[model samples]
Target: MGQFTPESLAASGQAFELTTAGGCGVFVAEVHGERLWIHGAGAVGSKNLTQDGLALFEAMALAGGCRFIRFETDRPGLVRLSKKAGFKTRAFVMEKEIKKC
Candidate 1:
């Protein structure tokens, strides 16, 4: 995975940043059909990370006319927060690297 700067995200016109009193979050979103898909996001490791992220998601959904928000993350803390935000696991991804001579 790669990290994105707020300026870069803004240049792409598909992402935004949410800054709260306690922390800040970066998110990238896309509207497809009736749902808003959050391709990626990251927040400073603070107590308000979850709050900032959720608020950003809601704002994007509202502005984009999307009925739902979808995103993926492997962080355990985020997993727990996602559950709190009413998200359920849909699938798991596994990968391995192969070396060639």
Candidate 2:
């Protein structure tokens, strides 16, 4: 929403906008290499992202010939959405090195 900036989007690639006439939501995707990544997604006054959002992603993948899609967000709700949309989660480890000898 208001959190995005033209400069930020320009950094990723060419900028564009699409509104779903309030029936869905607004999302921005940029083609990275051969994949289109969701740069932003939002539905005003809605707690959950619109189903159209999912469709938009699907359409992009199909059009771009993307065989895989990757997304990560800090929002737990989004994680749930991803799961509901047929995604699996994998646990990973983070190790830090302590150097003092």
Best by lDDT: 1
Please provide, for model 1 over 1-101, each residue's C-alpha lDDT reduced to its tens digit, 9 standing for 90 to 100.
Answer: 56876666555448767777777877777788887887657777586778667767877788878888877787898888788877788878898987998
RMSD of each: 3.2, 5.9
Worst ten in a row by lDDT for model 1: 4-13
Screening candidate 2 with a backbone cut-off below 3 angstroms (N, C-alpha, C), the clashing residue pairs are none
In TM-score terms, candidate 1 sits at: 0.75
Q: What is the lDDT of candidate 2?
A: 0.62
lDDT of each: 0.76, 0.62
Q: Could you estimate the TM-score for every candidate?
A: 0.75, 0.61
* lDDT accuracy of residue 4 in candidate 1: 70
